[model samples]
Target: MEAIFALAVGIMAGAGIYLILRPRTFQVIIGLSLLAYAVNLFIFAMGRLRHGAPPVIDPRLGSDPALYTDPLPQALVLTAIVIGFATTALFLVVLLASRGLNGTDHVDGREPEDE
Candidate 1:
């Protein structure tokens, strides 16, 4: 399971970096989303993976460590997911506006002028 998560994180980072380097606004947006996903996953993974563990503590159990997942990572990831969504929305709106204003979605706008 750890290996699987590691693989996922690696793939997300690799794809995000590759897409971000593209000379198009859409690709950049995608890359940002991908990177955000990778980051969120990485943060959540710090809580440690467990099977069939409820995150909330049960007072009846007299403080059993194995009964609950780490709440800190869950909280952090939730906040990050919300922020990431807002960022992605903002980027999309900006991409649209820029395209409308300049009539192109490419990062550099017009092609280079040849001498």
Candidate 2:
């Protein structure tokens, strides 16, 4: 499971980096999203893998930490996901607006500004 998580993170980072280098606004946005996903996954993976248990303690069974996965990583991942959605939405809006206003979606500007 750990190896799988590591592989996922690596793939995300690699793709993100590749996309980020592209000279297009949309690609940059995708790269950022991928990077965010990788970070979220990495954080979630830090909690370790567990199955068939809830983080909440079962009073009837007594407190045994091993029975549950750490909840902190789960909470962090949830928060990250929400933030990521908002960020992606904002980026998409910006991309659309830029295209509407300038007729181009490249960061280097459709027409070079006079210096």
Candidate 3:
């Protein structure tokens, strides 16, 4: 499971980087989102992977610290998700306005010449 999760993160980060280098503004936005997702996954993974474990400690259970999952990473990831969403929305609004004013969605503000 860990290997699969790591592979997924690597793929997402790689794709995000590739898309970010593209000429289209929309693609860049999507790339940013993908990168954010990859980072969130990485941060979440830092909390350790455990099955059937509660996020919070149960008083009834002895405080061996292994009975519960780390909640810090979860909380951090949740916060990052909210912030990433807002950032993406803002980027979209800017993209639309730029497209409207320039009549193009290219990052360079002009369409590529036909070769």
Candidate 4:
């Protein structure tokens, strides 16, 4: 499972980087989103991957650290998700406005020349 998770993160990061290098603005947005997702996953993974673990210490349980999962990473990821959504929305708005004003969705606000 750890291997799979690592592979997934790696793939996402790679794809994000590839898309970020593209000339299209939409692709760049998507790339940024993917990169954000990858980072979130990486951050979340830092909290240790434990199945069936409670996020907080139970009063009945003697406050052993191993009994509960680290909640910090979870909270950080949650906040990041919210921020990412807002930023994505803002990016979309800017993209639309730029498109309307410049009549192009390319990063440079102009159509690409044919090679």
Collision count of model 4: 0
lDDT of 3 at 17: 98
lDDT of 4 by residue, 21-115 (tens): 99888999999999999999999999998888989888988789989999999999999999999999999999999999999998999987886
lDDT of model 1 at position 39: 94
Ranking by TM-score: 4, 3, 1, 2
lDDT of candidate model 2 versus the reference = 0.87
Single out the weakest 10-residue window by summed lDDT for candidate 1: 106-115
lDDT of 2 by residue, 1-115 (tens): 6788899999999999999998799999999999999999988878887766686788876788877779999998999999999989998998899988889888765855674
Query: Candidate 1 regions off by >4 Å?
Result: 59-62, 113-115
Steric overlap count per candidate: 0, 0, 0, 0
Best by lDDT: 3
Error at 52, model 2, angstroms: 3.6
Per-residue lDDT, model 4, residue 62, is 75
lDDT of each: 0.90, 0.87, 0.95, 0.93
TM-score computed on alpha carbons, candidate 1: 0.90
The TM-scores of all predictions, comma-separated, are 0.90, 0.86, 0.92, 0.92
Candidate 3 C-alpha lDDT tens digits along 1-115: 8999999999999999999999999999999999999999999999998788888888888787878999999999999999999999999999999999999999988898995
Model 4 CA lDDT for position 92: 90
- Greater lDDT among 1 and 2 belongs to 1
Question: Higher lDDT: candidate 1 or 3?
Answer: 3
